[model samples]
Target: MVSAELLKILVCPSCKGDLEYDVNADTLTCMGKHCPECGMPVNRDGKCADKECGKISKNFVGLRYRVEDDIPIMLIYEAEKIPLAG
Candidate 1:
């Protein structure tokens, strides 16, 4: 389990967004949507939602980081991008 103090300073490496920690699961999830290609949260559907970019995806994706020994990995390369299932 991650300590509250350590969890407070953690954020997503990719989007710099807030991360939700699950103590029992020992995992941290990025709350923001991100484009798998651009590495940016440009769209609500995990694509470049920008009008100019005009990229869209049916899949919604976000990142998940694992916490080991109360320390978060916080590595973008190591982070897993999981497709959100509705």
Candidate 2:
């Protein structure tokens, strides 16, 4: 996983747009609406928004990463795309 610092600087590879952070999941995310940019999400309860978008990884690609610990599971390959429940 890239450091919070690096994640802050990272952008969506597909669109070169800004990525939003999911603090609870400790992950970086960029979930676009139908446009896949100018991101606008309607937050819900007890579920992760960006995480679900990442499951499909339908938008962002070519995810590069930097690890902070021996955990060594920061790669996008490790991130499975899923859908966010409203």
In order, candidate lDDTs are: 0.74, 0.40
Candidate 2 local Cα displacement, residue 50, angstroms: 23
lDDT of 2 at 6: 69
Residues 1-86 of candidate 2 have per-residue lDDT tens digits of 44566665666543355666554455555443221221323233312145545232234222322234623234444443334432
Spell out the clash pairs found in candidate 2.
54-81, 55-80, 55-81, 55-82, 56-81
Cα deviation at 61, candidate 1, in Å, is 1.2
Give the winner by lDDT.
1
Off by over 4 Å in 1: 37-40, 43-58
For residues 1-86, write the lDDT of model 1, one tens digit per residue: 98888888888887778999887889999957766544446555446644555567665568889987778998866778887765
Per-residue lDDT value at 51 in model 1: 50
